[model samples]
Target: MPVPRRLFRAPSRSLLARLAALIALLVGALLVWTLSTVYEQRKLMHRHQAERELQTIGRLQAQAVADWRTSRLADANALTDDSLFAQAVARWQSAPQTEHEATAFVQERLRILQERARYSVVSFVAPDGTVSMGNSSKTVPDAEKKALAHAIESAAPAIVEPRRAPFFAFPFFSLMAPIFDGTRPLGAVWLVMDVRTSLYPLLSPWPTASETAESVLVQAQGKDALLLTPLRRHGELETPTVVSASDTARPLVQAVAGARGLLYGRDDRNTPVIAVVNAIAESPWLLVSEIEVNEAFGEAATRELWVLSLPVSAAVLIAALLLGGWQWRARLRESALKDKLAQNMQWLESAQKAALVGYYVYERSGDTFTLSPMASELFGLTPEAPVARTQWLAQVHPADRAQVLAGLDEALRERKPLRMQYRLVDGSQERWVDMWGEHDAPSANARMTGTVQDITERQRAEEKLGQYRTALEALVRQDPMTGVANRRALTEALTVEWQRAARIQAPLSVLMIDVDHFKAFNDRYGHLAGDECLRKVAKALARTVARATDLVARYGGEEFAVLLPATGRAEAQAIAEKLRLAVRKLAIVHAASGVATVVTVSIGVATAQTKTAMRSEELGRAGAQANAERESLHLIHQADQALYAAKEGGRDAVVAQAEAPSSTALVGSGAAPDPTVSPPPPRST
Candidate 1:
């Protein structure tokens, strides 16, 4: 400044100035790039909003269907209550044997039930499927009546069927429940509800005016389905295409094939439309909502247009006129910046080395790459030469490579964060590393910036934790030696099964299993070997029962309980026989009988769907109205009687138990008893 130095002597333009100029040029370019990036982010946000809207509709569908099914189930359960049928049958059965007496009794019942059950009519059927009594317009048509009497259900407390009625020629969901003489099916009661009107309130505000959307209920089977149209979207044509499970029209079949939740409907052409589905509880139906492109993206498209242009124009305006001198300075600055950039890059390399972690960027579009010193160390490099990702991957364990790529690809495609643990070799020795990454979609290649850390100790701890959890879970539920449920487990299972049976008209059965001569056997054999014998029997039970619904548990002492949820008596009996035979096969010594053979067990079978089923299947010690409740007394009495009967009849057999209905017995209780009922025809071994 003092001497007014010439251009050559202006301190060689100073490296700092040059670098600052280069930074300005780079910043200008970065500002343009930043505007583009912001535009993309806006577009992504709008798309995300659409996804959110669809997800909301999906939840709405699920809730609507659940509400509908719950209503129907409640109606069905109320209609099939045992008390109503018992009252009708008791009056008819107790009185004179004349047809006129029975017909008169039936006519009175039909009128009372039609008013109470909110139905057009109600009718009665004898054990032989004959309609002995009815005052209703819908009598048992000949076609259904022929199939009704020998309906193969010797113990269906209630049944549902399709029948002809005067109100609607088209068949509706109909049911038949029997009055019981102990375990016998005496007569039947039928109930029906109109599907469309009864279910209208459940599917409300559905064809959402905000979006041209409608929700439908479809029944999904293996590959075919039944459609129940509840709501219609705008512009959606009601093309009733009845495609079968075995339809040869490949496209239609595939579209409706899974017919799972959240599906779209297309015209006969199978064009694209967006749909979402949710399944109704306990019923074979699905609730689905569909949206058109216009409905789904109309607002988003408008938002995208506004979001794209404004920032870009501002960036362009800033880039013009005022930036020319900056550009000249930037060009000169770039050359000097190389050295400074080298220095900054060295800091990154040093930072990675100090941290014992590695940084990596996976570029989906380009093969170009760079590695820090720590990354080089992880990939078996000598710290003399840098390692490329492709070469580093070559050193990765083969089993892990496919998994790593899958994680990487997923991160790249959906722009989702990813994490993975895998092994890599360093100097012929394996080292485990855990990696975490953030997906960056702004990059054309959809890159990931991730960090990796050695996690060999963490993996070992995880394995130990898994084993501990399994052991703890087993301790909570299982018998130590037998690998069956303990008392606590059985109680939980009973609650779960009871709720399920109540929800669906599905049957649930229980067998109060007790080993016949266990005290004698234990007296002969030591407790250790007795424990072993139980283990053997439990093993047999585990093998013999075919269905997953069956659960075996040790009740207390030598007694065990088998919970057969969603099973009828026939199925329960089948499993019981298998279990009984399986115990005989074990051959544990019965010391009292002087035989070194396996112990035998007598099973008391009870089913919720049986005509004489008890409400308190396993009577609790206390209840809501303890003094007034006869169910508490009846169930305990019946179970004890059945146990005594099992002992009386034989050592190894099945005796089903039900309570005898007394005025003292609770009216709503499921138990119904008759003295004349006998054991079912003996099942073959």
Candidate 2:
């Protein structure tokens, strides 16, 4: 009866239970709204981050492609500027009878270069669109010939568009540079490199480790975007894949139209992707880096869900315990916020460390410095250690200390922003740092605050760039084979010395020396041995001319020239005799030589008294400067005439042509040249 009565009375709801139910409903609604807001914000943030990373990768790939093309063009230009090649071309152009020999020489050179540079083909294109000389037997295409003509007309190097070669059916591109004889265009030298092997590989590598990320190149073709390089994911598709310009959904189409920055578009596969585009400098190509949108954002969504769930669960637990533990709950919430703040600070510090950056505050009046933890670590000091101005200065590299100090003083006096780069030596280690600081208006107790970033990598890159510049200059001025000054360098030195001689009224002497029976020597020992012999001769000549002002250069094949400033005919003749003897001392055997059993030289010395105006016509003409330059050429002609005279008077002798002396005179006239002084055993041809 009692149980029946209690069940019928029904359970009366407790105040706590009703309040708990209401609280639960409110908390659930709040969590739903907050999670939605957080998810959207997180989604936007992830998208922005992906866009930034892709943009950076796109820009880097574009720069790399541009640099690669630039380097190839530079190589072609350098080859065209070769003195030996120019002289050979001049000889062939002036006298068609020498075509056979000149063609053989040029073909040999092209073959060597092709092997060294790994080119598909290298050709010398004549003005009439004929292949004068080439490494490959393949005929030059009409399109390539027209491009070469354009390059010759432009008087600069040109890069042709990629095309498939008929012979190998492989993709290739041409680099052409006009060959010049002073102001006259002497055809063009062109190189064909396989794009599949040389260029496509450079653009295919993605900077990111993610498999979904890739880089591609696109060029505008009519009203469509043409894929210039292969896609990493879809390797089966042939390059130059065409996409309509109206396809705004395609990143490549947008890129071809010069659209840059992050964009949402579909890839070739029609899959949604996040892409960044950058235009290649100096070319009508665009570099695109893209990642599948789903792949890029999947993890972000997962992380966002977890983050939202964690806060919701924590809030529900707090609400459940609110009735009996309100004070404890409040403390917990405060502590949680503090922990979050601390976590954010920790994250900021981590980011700064990763970027190799640090912050600092300098008190000018106290001459003391306060460094952030990262800054202290960069200086190889404990974070807790007090930093003094003197202590900081002591860490600076000895070589850079003066500049750093002066820069700081200037910045303080001017009350302006300061930017400086210097090296820091901590113990045995050295690091490069870029410091940027700004001070407020000058006052008795002004403070300077700014950031310091470690730029060691940038410094290394700059040093490497400087090294490359030095190497390029060496390629321009130094002979590749003999490691001496090239003809171009010789010409420049001659012009400079001529002007200097005119100013100082000093004599300028030139020695034009030729290796006797060099052709016979090459035929006897083969071209490889011939090259070795030339190197030896060049070394001997370089050793003979040790003065700082003296220059020894490879003028042409089997020929060398030396420039001597402030030297009279007598001194020049003595130097020429010394050079002749030096080559003889090498004892390179030559049985075919009529001059000597060993290698010998014919030397012609010419001395000009630049103080006096030798040509009256040059003195009166308005273009006297031009005529004076022509007089320098006249001096070279006089030296050349003497060279022929030396060869005429048998080899291994020095002939001098000077203003005061007769037209030509042989040096060491009394003695006959030694033939077997130190001759090697001759090999029969």
Quote the positional error of residue 111 for candidate 1 in Å: 5.5
RMSD of each: 20.2, 13.1
Candidate 1 minimal-lDDT segment of 10 residues = 233-242
Q: What tens-digit string does per-residue lDDT give for candidate 1 at 1-685?
A: 4755463443344565556555646754654464445446545655555555565656655664575455444444443454644555666666646546555655654554553334543665666665544354344655445435544263343333222245455435455554565555666665555544444334545433554555555554456754554344322213232447675332234435554444445633344456665555666555655666556665666665565445445444543432444346756445434544553345344434433467666666664334445765676654434345677678789889988878776766778788888998766567888788886767676666777766565456456645755554556577666888886677666665544443333455667666776656667777677778778877887777666667888765666777776566677777777788888888766766433354787777765553333354344435423422333333433443565577668668878775233333332234444334322233233
Residue runs of model 1 more than 4 Å from their true location after superposition: 1-57, 60-64, 70-87, 90-117, 125-172, 178-187, 230-256, 259-272, 313-685
Task: Report how far off residue 11 is in candidate 2 (Å).
Answer: 30
Model 1, residue 380: C-alpha shift (Å): 53
lDDT string for model 2 (358-400, tens) is 8888889888888888898887765645578888998899999
TM-score of each: 0.38, 0.55
RMSD (CA, angstroms), candidate 1: 20.2
Candidate 2 TM-score, C-alpha based: 0.55
